[model samples]
Target: MSTVALVTGATQGLGLALVEGLAQRLEPEDTVYLTGRDLDRVGAAVAAMPAGGAQVRGELLDVADPTAAERLAAQLKSRHGGVDVVFGNAVMRVGPDDDPRRIVRDYVEVNNFGTTRLLRAFAPILRDNARLIIVASSLGTLHHLAPSLHDRFDGPGSLDDLDHQVARWRDAVADGSARSGDWPGFVNIPSKIAQVAAVRILAADRRESDSARGILLAAVCPGMINTPTSALWWNVSDAPTPAQAANGLVDLALGPVDPAHYGELVRGGKVLPWSPASGRATVVPYAATTASS
Candidate 1:
């Protein structure tokens, strides 16, 4: 049977790029589901692909809706019987300019929730050699926010160490920290902690399932591309269009696979060493960090 793949947030940006890449890599026998919040945009994206001669279709999904992932899974199960690969790429964010707390919450809802939801809803349809690809940002890394109180749950180190820190913020809000337009924000450090924690838990769960014998699960950060949100950090440079990033995503999703690449993060077609001890995802150039702050 030909492979079947589903990519959420496929209207534009990285999601759109992934669709294009999948179009080129997947054979006409395979199927790629392009999804987005807007039906028209999803349709446009599907229409825009180079007709991989494969069965490419559009799915209107708004990951913000708690039931969106489940609904999509149901539709896919009925039409395709099973899905071989799933890319959880939709993300939600707040803040006019990618504020840390705002970004944190948004990432929790879409990135975190979307991942868990899809896995639960589609678990039954996943075949033996299936794959699940998660697109994460380097901002979530402990090294990225090194020396700061940012949370990291995949460890003996997590926001649990800074419980008091969150309490302080809550107290600040309660005591009126924002002086009417001073910008009041709540930092639920636990959320970020949980988001990263989910990654390891999910990977382990799939590995334990007999039904997923050779399934590959991974999380990757496509080098900060020039998406609208990223533009806030620095003038996008050496940035490949979403199209280029999608190529890497597709490679990981369906191009080829080796056991070593599983659970690894790749950039520009190479596996990036991501040990927290060495500040894998955390370390970055001064300019990028400065822009984020």
Candidate 2:
């Protein structure tokens, strides 16, 4: 039996990279579902693939839009009986004046909510040993971004970080230390802490799932991958190619799960430390305000 997988935000960055890698690793009997908002790019991606002998196709899905999730669910139900793997990879970022709050909200909506939508829609079809993976950032790790005194905080702390960052910006603007236009706030350590917390929540959700067995789910740090998404980074050209990151993700997708690896953030295909406790994930300082929204 071939394993079928679905990936969102599939036109570029980590999403597209994973699609390509899956094409190589999975069999022709297997199917890979690729999704994005741009229909043309989706078409182009399908046309450009090297015949993996596997059934590879693309679907247009703007994960942030609730309707799109419904449409996608119907389509999946009609076509593939169910999916063996689902990679909740889509995410969107916004600026100060953007709707629905900060970029973190958008990220959570697409990365977190969008992912859950896919799983819920396909719950009936998910195989006994299916895998569910959510791509998450290191910024969400509380230990790395929150004050050491706040070590006791966990999932809720992640949401609080967003509130804290916004408050900090208000204070900064009032003090004449920051600009007033930075509404809903600036990127700070707290935002990162929240993001990591979101990832942990995702892992926990899968761990408690009774629907699948030997299910492997994790949040990975692709490690400074160079793509159009991060073009502003000065060393983008020097950074590892998206293909490199995709390859690493493929390794993770195919690897066996050790209890120790669950809820872990990986770099260079190995889990890394996020705090002094070791083997924890760390977040790089905020660079793109766009990354935080």
Best by lDDT: 1
Candidate 2 lDDT: 0.61
lDDT (tens digit, per residue) of candidate 2 on 1-293:
67788888888778888898888888888889888889999999888878765678888888768678777767776776656777767776433444223244455556545655654555456666666666765554554542432343352434334335434543553454432232223342443443444445556556666323666655667767686656643458878887787887777776666556666666665665545565343433333332322
Q: Which candidate number would show the highest TM-score if scored against the true structure?
A: 1
Question: Clashing residue pairs in candidate 2, if any?
Answer: 28-53, 28-54, 103-293, 139-192, 140-195, 140-196, 141-196, 273-280, 274-280, 274-281
What's each prediction's clash count?
Answer: 2, 10
